[model samples]
Each structure stands twice: as C-alpha cells, then as structure tokens.
Target: MKALLSLALLLTWLGRCTGAAQVFMEPQLRARAGDSVLLQCLFLDPDSKGWTLHKVDWLHRAGAGTQEEMVFFYYSNHGVPAGRFKHRVQWRGNISRWDGSILLQDLRLNDSGTYECELRLLETSSVFMRCEGSAAQVWGASLLLPSSVTACVPSAPKPPGLCQQRGQPGPGAC
Candidate 1:
C-alpha cells in the first residue's frame, strides 16, 4: 500500500526595486503516476505597458539536494523542452501578461522533485526599481517559483487508505 500526500507551497515577495516585476505562485501539488499537474507562476509588473521577455526557463531537481536541470526553455517564438520532459510539458501562460506558468503531463515516479520557473526580461540595461511589499532588483531579474509533488504507485490488490486524496484548485484528473 502507498499514500500520496500533497501539501501547499509558500509565496513570499522578496525584493525592493520600486517598479521591477515580482512573481507570485500557487502552492505545490501532489498526484499519482500518469496524472498531470499545473505549476502556476504570475508576475506583477508595475509598468502597465507590456514588458518584453528575453527568455522563460523551467528548471527541475530530481529530489532534495540534487542538481537542477532544464525542463523547458522559451526564447523568441520557439520553446525547447529537455531531458525526460521533451514531450510531456507545455507552456500555458502568456509572457505579455507577465505569466510564466506551465502544465506538466504524464507524471512519473522519478519526476518527484522540485520545479522552478524563471522569467528574464529583454531589457537588462535599464535600472528598474520595484518596491512592492519590499523588493525587486537588478539581481532580481530572475524569479524563482519552485513547486513540488509527492507521488506513488499502488501495489496489486489496492489496499484501503492507499489512494491519493487531493482537492480544490488542482488538476481534477487525479
């Protein structure tokens, strides 16, 4: 018997650059093998005008203390998904709206790790100051919103209390 326990993630705005863009993310997720999950990330840009994006990168770590690798990257109009995520991930957010979210499909046991979303602007020479809640700096060009999921595969006979229990605001297919 196995159990899949899903927990919520924390979102903290850690910057002080008067008008620089900041990121906000939903909680982490939990699901079973063959399920799909959405990693949400939204950026709030002080400037009402649409901001130009240089690149959007999605990184993943196999587990705690493991090295992070590229899951997907978007530049210009082309997106490249790497490694095991080559055909299982999708970019479902619009950068013009400051959204950098993604949809991860075909969940696998080894995919149990931390996923991070980073957004870099095309304009780097300009010094922007964003002071919402506290920060947003030149050093803050990259936003890190990492979400993780814990999953499991049921053994034969499917013992009681071994099923995954997830609710509200998550993938309904689980």
Candidate 2:
C-alpha cells in the first residue's frame, strides 16, 4: 500500500514539472519587404511568482544547411543588432511582464524564409530568489513573399549575422 501511494505522489510531481510552463510562439508570420511584423510569445504558467524575460532573439537559417544565424539580441536593455540586421528588428513586447514579443520592421527579400522567435524566462521564488527556465524552441516563422518576389527569385545576399560567436543562448542551452 505504501509503495502504491508513493508511486501516485511521484506521478503527480512529474506531471507538474513537465506541465504547461513551456513557452510557445503563435505562428509563422510573413511581411512584405519594408513592412513590419509583431512577434508573439505566450508563457503558460499559472504560478504567481511572475516571470522575468531574457535573451529574446530572432534567428534565420542561412545557406542550404540546417544551422541558423542570429540577427537580433534582446538583452542588457538594448536590442543590439548585428552589423547587418541593424534597422530591421525591434522588440514589441513589454519588458516587465515577460511578454517577449518582438517587432521586425522593413522586410527584405533576404528576410524571406523561415524565422524563429527564441526566448527565456526567470521565475522568482518566495525567498526572493529566481530560477531561469531552459530556452524554448518554436518552428515555422516563415517570411511571406510579396507578389513582387517570384518563386525562382533568390533573395538578396543576407547581411552576415551569425550567432555562434555572439555568446547567444540556444534552446535548452541556458
């Protein structure tokens, strides 16, 4: 009987740990060249400890391989843009509530493709301490092609914005 009761408690604990605390992106958004977009993120946690958002970014898969590059960084209070991504992206969410939504203005042909909105959170405790969650991954932030762009048309050369050397965080890497 004791063993069965213990198993029940363990299952309950596991359920909470893997519960809805996960972060997710709304959907793949598309914008015309020189247009703007609103990146949305939802934090599905019910606990009142609140959330502290950190290290929000937008990544684009460069070339024909699987790896991607970081075009924007949203930490340290400044949305530092890579030399190329400058004047192209901005954060649209409220900094205080962990709304990590971002805004990207002026979509270029080089911007057409799959883009992902990456984000992190710091959950506070009753002891006045904080705990950070793993980086969440969402797929399919596709750039919609304007009627002007042909299927055979290759986008312009992307400004070199790689994430590898930038000390950027990865999904579950934090």
Candidate 3:
C-alpha cells in the first residue's frame, strides 16, 4: 500500500511539472508608416508556481524571399535592439507576469511585414526547461493609416472553448 501511495504522489508531481502553457500574441496587427504599434506576446502558464523567464527574442521578416532579421533581444534584465530597430524598439514586457510584449515606434514602410516573438523559460534551479508553446505574428502596413488602431485576431484556429475559458470571445468576436 505504501508503494502504491508513493507512485500516486510521483505521478501527481510529474503532472504539475508537465503542465502546458499557451504563448500567444495578436495574430495580426496593422500600423501605418511613422506610427507606433504594440506587439503583445502573452504566456498563460498552467503551473501556478510560475516559471522564470530566461530570455526573449523578436524577429522580423519583410517578405517571402527575405531573411528574418533579429529586431530585439532581451536577457538578464537587459534589452538590445539590432540594426535599424535600434532606438525604435521598446521592451514593454514584464518577466514576473509572463508578458513578452514590445512596442515598435517610428514605423517605416520597410517594416511592413511579419514579426515573431520567441521566449525561453527556466526552472527555479536555473536549468533550461523544455520550450512548449506557439508564437504570434503581426502584420504591418504603410498605407491608409488609421487614426486609432487596436485589434487582435488569432492567426490560426484554437481549441474550441479555450478562448471562452479565458473570458475571451474568440476570433472575429471582437
């Protein structure tokens, strides 16, 4: 009986450690030239204890044939913006809250494309944990600037009732 009890406890612990989290962002975003846009990357961690954030990287791709450019990098409480993104990218995220969002100011026509956010999490012991989540993308524009634009739509189909469970009305419900 003691052995069975021990096995049960071990299973419970494993379940807690393996709980999955969802990392998402505004699947699509639109901003005009010279405007500013916020690319929100949020992680809904299933573990109540929360995980330690190790780093976050943001990349951008201009078009189909273009290579992805490293736009931003954050680690050890420091942020670095690369290339043309220097001085234009702002770290608006908080590690404590699992928010890896960012703000891109002074948008240019060449910035019209897709942006991706990559995140890494670590265990309390500072050991690398398995990365298990999806990324979000943002689409930029240079024409027909809207005075005030704030919208988010999932880029792909999510599990039914997941958004509702989060008190969100799901895509197109906005």
Candidate 4:
C-alpha cells in the first residue's frame, strides 16, 4: 500500500508541474458596453507552495491607441497609479496561498480593451522575475469619470489646521 500511495503522489505532481508556469483566466465570459467583469488569474505549480505573486498590473488598448500604459498597479497599497482605476481596484492575494488575482469594482465602459496581469516571482534559486499575460478584447465605452467627482478630488490633502487657519489666526482670536 505504501508503494501505491507513493505512485499516486508522483503522478499528481507530474500532472500539475509538467509544463512551464503560466497564468489562466476564467469564466469563458463576455460583457456589454457598460458591464463590469472580474478577471481571475492563477499560477499553477504542483511542487512548492505555489508561485509567489509579487505584483499584478493591468494594461489597456483603446481603439487605435498603440498599447496604452498601465491602467493600475499595486504592491502593498503602493505603486498605484493616479488613473481611472485609482481607488476602484483591490487585491486580496497577500492573505492566503499567495493568489495574485485582483478585484476591480465599478468598472466603466472605457475600461474595455486588452488587459494584462503581470506576475513576479522568485525562481528555485530565489531569483526575482516577472511574467505578464493578457485579458481578451474587453469591449466597453471610452473612459470617463463624472464631472462632479473629478472636481472634488484634490492633488493632496490639506495640512493639519490649514483649513481652520484660513478663517482664524493664533488659535485665540475670534
């Protein structure tokens, strides 16, 4: 029985670890012009505790645009771009099993186009590296945020007491 168990384990490892590590997308889906879709990415490796997902990036190409820049990027709440997806994206992979998938909320029509998730990992020797895979044609409308919300966002928060200082002085005068 011990020999049989060992054989089973070996076959399982071979099946999941046989080929080059790659990212896979799910749902076999489609979305309309104003719909939001969640794209999931997985890295497969039977051996080891799964590939380390150091980072995930999204890219887009709208109409004739020549491969536009990164839509959003994240690593420990940092490296996020000031774009349409600035605060609408979140990643929950750091908590368990190191899943690199990201969840995007309130997706817009402009969010359409080809998207890619970039994965970075350490090889067997602990060497750092990165790999990227693309999302299928995401058909949606041109990217645009509501004028009211856009106007409310400031470049940065006002320093503490700055607002109070505007209408008063020395903190003692009326």
Best by lDDT: 3
Clashing pairs counted in every model: 16, 2, 0, 2
How do the residues 1-174 of candidate 3 rate in per-residue lDDT, one tens digit apiece? Answer: 000000000000112234334543343344545777666666564344456667877777665567878888788898888988998999888867766777888866566545656666665333222221132222344233212122112235665656665566774442
Residue 22 deviation, candidate 3, in Å?
A: 1.3
What are the models' TM-scores? 0.60, 0.50, 0.59, 0.49
Report the lDDT of model 2 for residue 19. Answer: 32
Q: Which residue ranges in model 1 land beyond 4 Å of their true spot?
A: 1-7, 12-21, 46-51, 125-174
List candidate 4 stretches off by more than 4 Å. 1-20, 32-35, 46-51, 63-65, 76-82, 123-174
Candidate lDDT (C-alpha), each: 0.52, 0.40, 0.53, 0.39
TM-score of 1: 0.60
Better of 1 and 3 by TM-score: 1
Global local distance difference test of model 3: 0.53
Ranking by TM-score: 1, 3, 2, 4
Q: Which lDDT tens digits does candidate 1 get at residues 1-174? A: 122424244443332333334444333345545767766566554344455755667777665578988888777877787988999998877766655667778765566555566566676633222111111111112433233542111123332322232222333332
Model 2 lDDT per residue over 1-174, tens place:
000000000000112234334443321223444566554543334244344555556565533455666666677677766646677767666556555555666655555434445554445222111111211222234522221110101112311231222233532232
Number of colliding residue pairs in model 2: 2
